[model samples]
Target: MDGFDAHQRQMETLCGRLELIADLLPDQADPTLCKFTSDGIVKTLSDAQAFEEKELFPALQALSLLETDMKEIFAQLREEHYEDLCFAEEVRDNLRAIIEGHPSQSANATGYMLRGFFEKLRRHMAYERYLVSALRTKKAPGTPDAS
Candidate 1:
């Protein structure tokens, strides 16, 4: 599969994993699970941000199918990515605090944060599905031979 497709699959797996995390948080909060989530999400968000900004965004930008109207959507997506990364770090720190025995300030708050993050992430994936569909239906102005 292409890089975009691969990243989409990764995001799907992450949503599943995050659902599992959501089910366990504030109740089970196992140190291993906390550490697993804390470590995994940061890396996953970082990689996705890099790929979207570098490869995916540029590819779309270079295509004729994307219009000025869509520019704002793309710009919003970039900002969302930054926000998502920052939010992931906050969640990671919270989870790590639990792993360190400090505990979150509130169980309800932890649940709220997890739900908020996943909801935002799911919205992003939905937008990307539309964008990717548009990309797939069009031909990029290039050949296998660069020249």
Candidate 2:
């Protein structure tokens, strides 16, 4: 109903979609399925990064500059974002390698790596939700808020 609520919902949906794709990845054994899932994951990661850059990062920046606790929280979030960047990069590289006909071991390793990345990413999303909830509670009512 409110801006914070909307943002929370959006974040939840985004994370859910990512989880769905991650879950689907293991079910795929054929190389084509692997490629499809890899591409899908890369796309999802790109969308997530764009959302963070355009929306989350700016909001966190404003909050950090204005509130001490928010600044700490933002620092943590920024760290998580950096981790996400690494995971996304690894996923992209692995996917590219697979596309390039890299060895089967590389594909297997990438699959394992992706599983770990997704798990970490899911935890990071949960942490972000907690941070967002805290900020939302602190924000003044009737103030315009970004989605």
Candidate 3:
């Protein structure tokens, strides 16, 4: 599959997992669930970041497939990636605290953080899908595929 399609699948999986984690946050009774979700988030974010930086961004740049305005969009997406990384790290820290017998936030606070992160992730994915559709619509000047 294309990079966009693969990324979309990965994102779909991540979002589904995140949704489950969000649902579990209210009870805060399962340390195993917290650990599993935290680990998944860390791994998924790392893989997604690497794929975007090493594969997707380079290909887009090499082909000049995106319009000039897309540069701003790319920048914003990169920023969002950074933000997601930070959020993931925070989640990891919370999990660590729970594991280490340290004081942690209330269940409500944890739930709030998770819900906000999930919402942001959904929004980010939607924007990326829009960008992919836009790129698919654009063709180089004078090309046979140009409309």
Candidate 4:
């Protein structure tokens, strides 16, 4: 499968595990589990963002016809990437706290954090996928005319 599909699959799996962890936190389940799961989420997402910015963004920018729209979208995406990295780090720290026996938030609060992170992350991935699809169907400027 393509890189996007593979990244998405990994994300989905990690999210599912996080959802389960969120369901039983601060009072139930093994706290160490959160540490493991959060680490994977952080690493995988960080890698995905790095890959997209380094490789995908440059390629998309080369499509002159889409440059203006892509500039806006790419800017927004970079902002989101910053926000997401901060959020992921927070989640990892919180999970690490749980593992270290120094939990700060209640079960509900931790659960909310996990849900918020995953849901927002899913939305981010969806937007990227849409852009990739657009590349396939839309013609690029400065290229030989198809018609």
Candidate 5:
């Protein structure tokens, strides 16, 4: 698959995984499950971030697809990526805290953070879907009108 399709599929998987992790947060003290979930989160987000920065944004910019009206959307997407990275760090820290014998202290807080992150991520995915649709519908310059 192309980079965009791959990224979209990754995002969908991440969303489902995040929701699972969120639901398991309150009882996430089990070493095996905790390790599995946290590692998955870190790996998926890290890969997605790298792809977006190294491939997706540059490709779109080269195509001049992020011009005019799409500039703001593109900027917002970049900003959201930064926010996601921060959230991922917070999740890792919280998970570490739980694993290091602070489960009672971190469980609720972790749950809260995950819920907020998931909601924001869902919105971001919706925006990305809109952007993709916009890209597909956009015609090349000087092309004959479909209508």
Candidate 6:
């Protein structure tokens, strides 16, 4: 497949993983189930980061100087990536507390915080998908819309 097609597939896969985490968020808030859910989220984020750093980031860098629109899209995506990192850090902190056998109240509080983070992350993924779609369309100039 072409570069755009490959990128689109990668984005879709990443979004699918994010959706799984989003779906598990409520269950994860149970404190008892938090460890499994947190593990899943950490895995998902790590996979996403690997894909972005290895594939997407390089593509964005190469394309950025070729088009103003592409550069702006890349910038927005990079900013969103930073936000994702913050979310991941929060997740790590919550998981660390849970692993340390924090008080029940603390576990519940962390679960609630994790739920909020999941919601924000879900929205961020949707926005990133939209931006990626737009960038793909713009990058292809008259190519038939495949997204």
Q: What is the Å distance of residue 41 in model 3 from its true position?
A: 1.3
Clashing pairs in 2: none
- Residue-level lDDT of model 1, residues 6-90, one tens digit each, is 7777777776666666777667766776687788888887787788887666666666566576577678888888899899899
lDDT of 2 by residue, 1-147 (tens): 134445445545544544554455434445554456556654565566566656665665555534466556656766777777677667656655655667345444655676677677767667666656655665545534543
| Candidate 4 per-residue C-alpha lDDT over 1-147 given as tens digits, one digit per residue, 9 for 90 to 100 | 136667777888878877888888657847667767866768988888887898667666776436367788789889999999899888888888888888778878888999999889888888777766665556476533222
Ranking by TM-score: 1, 4, 3, 5, 2, 6
Model 5, residue 81: C-alpha shift (Å): 1.3
Instruction: Quote the RMSD, in angstroms, for model 2.
Output: 4.7
Please give the lDDT score at residue 67 for candidate 2: 46
- Candidate with top lDDT is 4
Show model 5 residue runs off by greater than 4 Å: 28-30, 58-69, 104-106, 139-147
- What total of clashing residue pairs does each candidate reach? 0, 0, 0, 0, 0, 0
Pairs in clash, predicted candidate 3: none
Number of clashes found in candidate 5: 0
- The window of 10 residues in a row where model 5 has the poorest summed lDDT is 138-147
Instruction: State, as a TM-score between 0 and 1, how close model 1 is to the true structure.
Output: 0.85
**lDDT digits (tens) for residues 1-147 of candidate 3:** 155667667767766666676677645546776667677787787777677766666545545765576577668778988989999889778766765656388767866777788788878778766655555575445432211
lDDT value, candidate 3, whole model: 0.68
| lDDT, residue 86, model 6 | 76
Per-residue lDDT tens digits of candidate 6, residues 1-147?
Answer: 134345444545544443454455433534444455455655566566556656555544544534466656666766877777778667765665555566334544654665566666657556655645655655544444434
Estimate candidate 5's alpha-carbon lDDT, on a 0 to 1 scale.
0.65
Task: Tell me the spans in candidate 3 whose CA falls farther than 4 Å from its real position.
Answer: 58-68, 99-103, 139-147
Q: By lDDT, is 2 or 4 better?
A: 4
Q: List the residue pairs that clash in candidate 1.
A: none
* Model 6 pairs whose backbones collide: none
Q: How many angstroms is residue 15 displaced in model 5 relative to the true structure, after the best TM-score fit?
A: 2.7
